[model samples]
Target: MKWFEIALVVLTLGSGLVLLLDKLFLAKRRATKGGLLDSEEPALVDYSRAFFPVLAVVLVLRSFIAEPYKIPSSSMMPNLLIGDFILVNKFAYGIRLPITNTKVIPTGEPRRGDVVVFQFPGHPDMPGDPQRGENFIKRVIGLPGDRIGFHGDTLSINGQPLAYEVKGEYVGKGRGAEMNGATLLSEALPGRTHTVLEYLGRANPAGQGDWQVPQGQYLVMGDNRDNSDDGRFWGFLPEQNLRGKAFLIWLNCSGWFCKDGFEPSRIGSGIQ
Candidate 1:
């Protein structure tokens, strides 16, 4: 359980307890004695009763329905930029226990081409991060029992090359303008399509060779093929480590290098 989630649980439980105690010992007594006006009630007690329900609702929504995340890297490139504030649909996967993230209900499964956020399974050679379960966003490329490979820039799944239509150079804006000259390609998966950036000068590209994906795990790669540190570097992601599916970009703000701050054109944009 993350510290922040634990804190929310504690706060909710504490406030609920206070409210329950007040209802049983004070509110009921006042009700029988012709009721007490708002000003007459103990300030702390009244506040607890008023705020506990609000806190509980917020906790439930944030923990299980949807959660917001800020994009911190250009790994997703044309699809998701740095400073894009996104909303992840937690229930799209399943209902899980708060903090622990233990799945209790099976809602759905991830499909090829779906964009997802999950805990970054650290590389063995690298030191473990303080936030070991830090999240990352990437496209689902390989599923359990699937064979995935890449020859140069072309991706092959089960020995069949995934189709790509060149979309010419992508002129990046805001925080990712440095990638303005990169090649853009519309990659087609079985059920969906998304644009990907192919930065020049490959440094250990992930889709170079064939790999057999294991059971109960997934192989993911970033849209910015040459730049992301993803499944290729840290191995497959256990299904249990998934956070949620990122489905929307609610807001985009100036990050690093924007001439005029907010990217209103990108607002309310559905994440492909």
Candidate 2:
């Protein structure tokens, strides 16, 4: 479990338990001891009572409905930018329990071209130990039992080459300015079309490969093809590691040190 999820669960359960114990045992005991202020609740009980409801509501909403995330990298550039505060539909793929991440209810599977936030399958910090990695956002390129290939900045799915239309040279702003000269292209991924960035004149030997997606895994790639460290470098993503589908950018802030950090135009924009 992430640190935030662990803390939220602990605080919520602790407060609720305190409130329950006070009502069931402590309050009754105080009432029997005549002179002991039966009507006055203890400080801990009072605080628990005041906070339990609010915490419980937030827990439910965040765990089951939707949750917010901040984009700290340019993996999905041109679509999801650095400092973009996005919303993920928690129940879009399935209804999973908090911390444990066990899917109690099946909702729907992810589609091709869908932007998804998932736990990185590889442990970069502790290599060779198969632990859950940090959350990563990417676009689903291949589904189960599919043939996915990539070479020369072009993508092929199931032996069919997808078309790429050169839009123009990308001119990025803020933190994205580093990718100013990247070639912007519109990729036709089956039913969807999305913008992608590639350094046209450069070689991406590491990203050139082909793979057969297994029955319980997926193939994902970053929109910033040349700059992203994704499935191309690691391997296929296990379906169980998936968190949810990213659908919206609710806020954007450049950085804490930057003046006028807020980018109001990106707010309330839907993620394609």
Candidate 3:
């Protein structure tokens, strides 16, 4: 469910609880004080007094402030791994209404190298499907009007090759065990620097179709180059599908078992 929808559900339940408490406690107090014993009247007053305000606050905060999302895929490995709970700054891009996702305030636009979480535009019916509406976290490699290409596994943005230096081999985890042979590298993108993984012997698919990013859109790719299914296969993420910028890794667990314990190094780490 969309964050706004979830907020609405919570608001509804909280309001209901408050109303029930008022009827059970406040109504009895008034009755003891010699007030008119109108049962239906109390229900009306209780609902109006308790529910609307609380729901309004929740709607404003969640729609314009921040929202939490969990990483459920390895598409952004090394930067964001499976089981990583992250906080997305909703207002980082702009302020939008909850359910309708209509932007109400203009905050700012996404920049190159920002790690963003967006709803996949690929099959609309499968919204939130792990493989469909699946929230994808990736770096904005190419902006509107930018020309991007890949040569021998190297990324060339607007005809300029990005700087890359091999660091070492990545030690895979859980389902990532099969990618243990992937090489880890420190790639410098514009003003930001982050680690990326590349599988050995996998030649960059050259002569691939080029894309001219349209207005109000961006091209994103995973840090784990070969492993991610990004703009190369799917397509550019529309500005409206953007959820927010992932700024922090609040928690990281090895897997569902959480047996590996907290990763101290990854704690409080800022997303690129």
Q: What is each predicted model's overall lDDT from 0 to 1? A: 0.84, 0.88, 0.77
Ordered by TM-score, highest first, the candidates read 2, 1, 3
- Those runs of model 2 whose alpha carbons end farther than 4 Å from true positions after fitting are 35-39, 123-132, 257-260
- Cα displacement (Å) at residue 152, model 1: 1.4
Order of quality (lDDT): 2, 1, 3
Tell me which of candidates 1 and 3 scores higher on lDDT.
1
List model 2 lDDT by residue over 1-272, tens digit each.
38899899999999999988987988888878752573477888888988999999999999999999999888899888898999999999999998877889999999999999998888445577554567889999999999999988789999999999999999977877778989999999999999999988684898899999999899999999998888888888998888899999998887774453677889999988
TM-score of each: 0.88, 0.94, 0.78
TM-score of 1: 0.88
Q: Clashing pairs in model 3? A: 128-133
Which RMSD does model 1 reach against the true structure? Answer: 2.9
lDDT (C-alpha) at residue 127 in model 3:
51
C-alpha RMSD of candidate 2: 2.0
Candidate 1: 10-residue stretch with minimal lDDT? 199-208
Q: Which stretches of candidate 3 lie over 4 Å from their true place?
A: 3-58, 123-134, 172-178, 204-209, 254-261
Greater lDDT among 2 and 3 belongs to 2
Error of 2 at 192 (Å): 0.5
